[model samples]
Target: MTTRTDSDHDFLASARRTLDLEQQALAALAARLDASFEHACRLILACHGRVVVTGIGKSGHIARKLAATLASTGTPAFFVHAGEASHGDLGMVVESDLVLALSNSGETAEITALLPLFKRLGTRLIAMTGHSGSTLARHADAHLDVSVEREACPLDLAPTSSTTASLALGDALAIALLEARDFSPEEFALSHPGGTLGKRLLLKVADLMHTGAELPLVNHGTSLRDALIEMTRKGHGFTCIVDAEGRLSGIYTDGDLRRTIDHHGDVRRLTIDEVMTFGGLTIEADTLAAEAIRVMEQHRVTTLVVVDTEQRPQGILKMHDLLRSGIV
Candidate 1:
């Protein structure tokens, strides 16, 4: 029976050893990277159809993640279970497509069984395996050697260090392809529209601004009291003061009211034009909402009027809108 103190010490030592072994494996993988890595990248870049990533068990899990990373970064890819390919999933492979197979031993029976079929379909194969001379590697058009000196597992049987090496190599390949294609953040956002980065990159001012009846508008010559009513009615803390032609001439806000009270004792005798700041901070409707946030932060304001090409007020964007849309 081991004491709790002994067990804790053993656990910590084991964890440290495992991490050190895995880090060394990654370092070795990086040092040994040669033309084969470039060859793999070229195959993926030239692929006319989607890359089908396949493996079994733990390798299969890594394959799925690699496929997702590749897809999100600009390469088209999807995962298929190696064991199920012989049943019917192999039909997904086509002549123009490419196959990326992962197996630590490079002798996964289920994966090797599909090799002849992949070759028959005239699909290019890229193998990520620990065994360089294995049948899978021998048959591959490009072989990425993910061999590790030893597993992090105490028994050196579990797929610990080898799996980490394979995953890291897969990431390297995906990022290389991403740079080769010059994939942009906006393009990455298209695949992840529900995420925070997507909101920051894809959302435009037009998408989050209040328009039509929601806009708080008061003409330039309107009385200050009436403009206050409009501002309160819209609940955006400000109102757009426009000219007779409905073009934006200025804006009045809570700050302007404070300045007005200080400048003149009797506020009731004043019109909006007497207190409003002419053509204050404004942004185009086509501008990015992230850019709007930056402008507000730099100028220390809570709202901006959205204008069109003709300098007419189209809509209004408040900081609250950005907060609600998860852009802030």
Candidate 2:
């Protein structure tokens, strides 16, 4: 029951107008993409050394993000502040490396000053600029046009739509290189091993399954009471049943025990084989934990037996194991 005010309406309108301007700028940018963009991507892919991204002002911020995106997506790249490069950071660039310079005006003094040194060192240059006729673009082997018709800023001086266009263009380059390199999600996960994606891709059933003495295992013909004791001791809510050859034969859970009592009025007379679910869902120890979760969810079960090629139970995994591993 809050009252709307004139200021609130003005704020919403301003925000929407900004978004519309930026969206139009992106559409224009996309429409103008040509062989220059492809040439830039090819230059990066062909470079023997890393991609050295440098820029100044707001363009520098966009360049920094572009470098990060490239690095994470199979392109080895890093950012060097243009202002810092003139002082001493330029030494990080080698002849084998390729330079990607960003400048909205294409005449940024800090960036323009490094052009001659880059030429002397035989470093390849690719420029992204709002003005293709500027010196930076003239010297570049490949030039990308990121020019926008107008800024989202009300005064048309705050670099709103231009920056968005540059950032979007950077994403296009990263994703193009990602696809060109045939990058896989598993490879992406390796770079982000500390996040949830890493857990989903790198974690395997063997990594979190209960093994050795911790597994709740009972031999065929073992009494239901003894199986329940093993389940309680292992704390997995279920026990694996195996034959004399030590191969997994069936499984017994608390649910099965309850049904057994209801059907046969059994107390302590039932054997593990008498009520166990025959050949219950099993997964390979090498299977991904995320895939295990999929199987558990698809079947509406909470546990799975880890088995080898010979169908011998190696370990036991439960939904709790996946949840505790932060893979769910």
Candidate with best TM-score: 2
Model 1, runs deviating above 4 Å = 1-13, 244-247
Collision count for each candidate, in order: 0, 0
What lDDT tens digits, residue by residue, belong to model 1 across residues 173-253? 999999999999999999999988999999999999999989999987799999999999988888998888888998888
Model 1 score (lDDT): 0.93
Off by over 4 Å in 2: 1-9
Query: lDDT by residue for model 2 over 1-328, one digit each (tens)?
Result: 8988876668878899999999999999999999999999899999999999999889999999999999999999999999999889999999999999999999999999999999999999999999999999999999999999999998999989999999999999999999999999989988888889899989999999889999889999898889999999998888999988888999988898789889989568888878999999999999999999999999999999999998899998889988988887
